[model samples]
Structure formats: structure tokens, C-alpha cells
Target: MVEADASAPCTDPDIGNVAQARRRTRGPSLDKTAQTRQQIAEAALAEFVEVGVARCTMDRIARRAQVAKGTLYLYYPSKDELLRGVVEHALRHSAVYTALQRKKGETVRAFLRRSLLPTMDAVENSERGLLARLVLSEASHAPELARLYKELAFDAWQTYVQDLLTLAVKEGELKTRSVSRSAQLLASPFWMALVHNSLLAPDAPQKLALKPLVELLIDNLFSRSAGDNANVKSQ
Candidate 1:
């Protein structure tokens, strides 16, 4: 029989515990790396918002992040990748998606007030708003980054809102033949308003008031009968 390889991990029981201990010791280092990456993403978001994606260079982001330009490369290989990181960072921290959480027996109007209002507020009055506007403005020139933004941010919100509408239909809170269409209808006005404000004059009178529109959507679009049908379909 040949001798065991000297560099191989030990099969001894004590060695296994030691290996796990070493892994535990490395956790702090891993946390530091993640923190550094997040810092870079935040810096990149600031740069993108200030000067837009095309003009936002890796050097600017690296300087803002207080990291070496080389270190920035290690975290994000290109400006496009960095832009995607910016979107990811926003999604991870934004309250927009958190607004989707529904409580037991809450009316659809109550849910909209809790969820939709916060979303509109975030779009109106946060660094997140600037970042969103940057993405929209730059998307035409940078389709790849746009696609990534859609995949990471837009798709997530669309899926969640659609599911919320579907659940509402099942709960008899919404009257709709298609939850997909209903979700689109519910969100279109707010989205359009945000787009208008971001692209047009901020104080435009054409801005859609979220509260009244939400009330109209609920009053005209929901029905107790729809929920009953949904229950029957499930059975």
C-alpha cells in the first residue's frame, strides 16, 4: 500500500474539527470583503447618479469608494458590471419591495396605502430616485446595463406585484379575469407618473395623484364574487 499524500486533509476526527474552526476564523475576513464590495457599489451609485453611466468611470468610483482602482476591478470588472451592482445594492436596501408585505384581513385599499405609497415616495424623494432616473436616461445607450436592471430590479417588482394581485383575486378582494392585466392596470399610472417626473418637469401638474387613483382602482376593479370564483376553482 502506498503512503497517503502529505498535503491531503487529515482523516483524523480531531483534524475535521480543526478544519471547521479555521473556517469559522475566516468568517470575519469574508465579511470584510463583502463590506468592501458594498462600499464600492454605493460609491458607484453616487457616481452614476451624478454623471450618468457613460461618464461614470471606474476611476471615479474607486476614488469615491476609497479603494485602489485595481481593487475596484477585482470587485467589478467593468463600468457596466458596476452599474448592475448599483442596481443590486438598491434592490437589497430599498423599501419599495418591502411595501408588498400584506397582513391578514387587510383591505386592498389598506394594502395599497401601505405598499404603493411608500414605493412612490421612495421614487420621489431618495437617492434611489436619482439612480432610477439615471438608469432610464442611460438605458438607450447602454442596453446591456438596461437589460440587467430589468432582470434584477424591474422583473422582481413585476413578479411580486403580479403575485399580490393574483392573491387578491383569490381572496375575493379584486375582480379580474386576468391577474396579469389587473396588476399592469394597477401599476401603470404610478409608473407613468414617476417616469414623467423623472424625465419631465418635477413640478408638472400632469403628475398622477397616487391616492385617488389607487382608490379608483380598488373601487372599480375588486369584487367579492371574484374571490368566490377563485375559491371554487381551487376546489
Candidate 2:
């Protein structure tokens, strides 16, 4: 896992702050500047995919982005930092994680539809797809970053699944002694699929039929277990 200090902050330091103790002068074209930053990130992603990140240079990124190399540094201190920006941007706004919204107390099935599927959808984009593959291939070299990616992928799903089990326990729908264990069981297959897709099966069909796998997983692990959760929907 990325040690807290070592993990790069995901947002642009200048723009992400919501408030300050004292008001300061505001830039008139903040939105325009932010758009430019997004453009650079988009261009960098393309450049990195077209040429591997190891081969990509700041000069090339700048040329692709139509921004000065120094300007790119203003937004990102280093190439690694810039790459972090691209990955973070993809995580929050990409097709998969972006639309996977969940209501409080949502069921385990809802969790997958909201979070996992959208992430899987993102696997189809060339730039993001390439980056994801690169991470998988190089994770051994940078294990911390790899672990951070895993946490970003599934931590919330675990929490949401756990919450659903807790709800079921309160309703007398589950006989589980520990909600955490049940949550683990619920999220295991989804996580396993994520692992296979991200690392082991990078060249696998872009659009895998995960529902069948999900059904098999739920059937094998759940199978109307004595303590099985009733409120959590399975598909």
C-alpha cells in the first residue's frame, strides 16, 4: 500500500482547496486555466499510451498538449506527479467509477453495478487501458503504487457491502456472527474479477460477461448459507 506520505495527492494543489481561513484574491480565468490543465492531462495520457511512459518525455507531452514544458511542470512537479494526475483523473471521472453511484445502505449487487462495472467499462479506452496494463506489468517494481491502485478500486465496495450485511443482521435476515466476514464473502468475487481483468487477463476480451462469473461466485460461496444475508441482492 502507498504509505500516506508517499501517496501523491490526486488534485491540483492550487484548485482543489474549498476554503481558507482568510479570503485571497481570486483569478478571473481560474476555470479556463483548469480546463487547460485538463487538456494537458488528456494529452499526456495519449502521449504515454502512444509511447510508453518510460519513453515519454516532458517535451513530447508539452508538444502534444500545446503547452509549454515549464507550464506542464507548474501543474505537475515531475513526470511521476503528472502521471499520478492522469491516473487520479481517470479514477474519479472515467467511465467505470464515474457513474457507479450508490445510495446509503445499498445492497451488495448494487455495489457491483455502481462501482465495478463502470471500472470495467473504462478498460476499453486505449489510453486508460494502456496505463492499467502498464501498472499491472510493473507492479512488482513499484509494489506500493500497485497496492494503492487496489485500495482505490475496492475499499468503498467492501464498506458498502459490510453495511448491507449489518442491515440484514439487524433485520434477522443473516445469521452471521460477524458482518465483516460476510462483507468479505460478498466482495471476494468482484475483487477476484478485478484482479484477473487488471493483471492476469489484460488481453482478454474487453467486454467480459461478469454476471455469470458473479452468479457462480455467489452460488458457490453463498448458497443460502445459514447466516446468509437476505437483504443483499444477488444476480
Candidate 3:
């Protein structure tokens, strides 16, 4: 009998069915898909930063990502969509945006301080800061980006803070006439520091610190005794 050639394609029906089954089951793994998406997002952000949103193009982003243009489109169909994706991805992983639950017996003020201060301390040097700067710099040029930033970052944070303030009031840890305004006040320092560092005087040797300002605000906002004293003195 003649020996079968090992190099030849298998002709046996059982072997052919097995081979077909393997082929049908094969595709990009979940890890690979996620990695590719991450690569594309990073590349898009780099392009946006380097050339501004107006000048950045899908073709350029694809080249930067080292992915086929078609592949880039598969992940993000258009520049606007890609910008949204990038911002959402960045915000999702941001320390500042992570959802934190108040510990058992933790005051809302204490929780805010514990949760926000550390993140705020590093905001000026973190990816969160970079995203804020990008939104500020491009807001005038790209209205849609500004809108998305507001929807995804600004308004979301405002709502989150508002909810916390409501909780504080319900728990009797805070006494504010308006939870909305108090939340806005609590948020103002971060924007001020961001503008001071990134826009108004980026090259200045001395930069504003966000953490201390936030810490001070937290103390004042949560000080029931101080509020009481003020009411007593005003009478």
C-alpha cells in the first residue's frame, strides 16, 4: 500500500468536518478586539492633540493607529463618533469619574473628601486633566465636542454632586438652602484651577493647587457648627 503524503490537504470526510468546524469557530478574540479598540482611541486622541479636532482626519488617525482605514471605520464610523468614543473611554477609566460608595457611617462630606481629594490632587498631571484641557481648547472650534463633554463630564458631575448634597441634607449632615447651588459651589474650584493652570497662565512657574481648595470648600460646606454660629451672630 502507498503511504499518504502528510503535506497534502486532508481528504478524509471526518478530518474535513473537523477542519471546517475549527474554521467556522475562529475569529478575533475578545481581548484582541478590546486591544484594537484601545489602540484606535489612543491614536485618535494623539491626532486630536497634535493637530486639533478640525484638522484631524479618519485617514490620519488610521495611519497613526497602524490600522487599516476600514478597520478604523468599523470601530468608529465618523470623526464625531470617534471623538465621542475617545472621550467616553477616557472618562470611563478616569479616577475622578469612578463611582464611589460612601462607607458605612461615613458622612457625605467625609466621603467626598476621601473620594475626591486624592483624585483632585493629581488632576493637573493626569489624563483627566488632559481631557479637560482638550475640551476647553477645542470647545470654540468643535461645538459638538463641547456638547458631548458637557453631557458626558460636566452635567454628569453636576448631577452626581447634587445627589450627594441631597443625601447630606436628608442625613442632617448639611444645611443648605439650595443643593443645586451648593453643588455648583463645590465644583467651582476645580474649573478655576484648571483654567489657571492650563489656559490663563500655563507657562507661569507657580500653579494653583486643586486639592487644598477643594479641602477648604468641603470643610466650609459641611461645617454645621459654623453655620449655626453664623445664624446666631447674624441675629
- Give the best candidate by lDDT: 3
In order of appearance, the predictions have TM-scores of: 0.72, 0.60, 0.82
Which residue ranges in model 2 land beyond 4 Å of their true spot?
A: 1-28, 95-115, 125-130, 141-144, 154-208, 215-235
Can you write out model 1's per-residue Cα lDDT over 86-127, one digit (the tens) per residue?
Answer: 888877777775646556667654676677666655566665
Better of 1 and 3 by TM-score: 3
RMSD value for candidate 3: 12.5
lDDT at residue 129 of model 1 (Cα atoms) = 62
Better of 1 and 3 by lDDT: 3
lDDT of 3 by residue, 147-206 (tens): 998999889988988998898787667788889998898879888999999889989999
Residues 1-235, candidate 2, lDDT per residue (tens digit)?
2133233333345542222311343532668667877888888777755655555677777788998755676677666677677776656555544544557666544454455544444454545455566565556665544665566644655775677667655655455667787667655554455567766785887635455655554444344553556545544
Candidate 2 has a TM-score of 0.60
Stretches of candidate 1 above 4 Å error?
1-31, 99-101, 107-109, 203-212, 223-235
C-alpha displacement of 30 in model 3, angstroms? Answer: 1.8
Q: How many clashes would you count in candidate 3?
A: 0
The best-first sequence of candidates by TM-score reads: 3, 1, 2
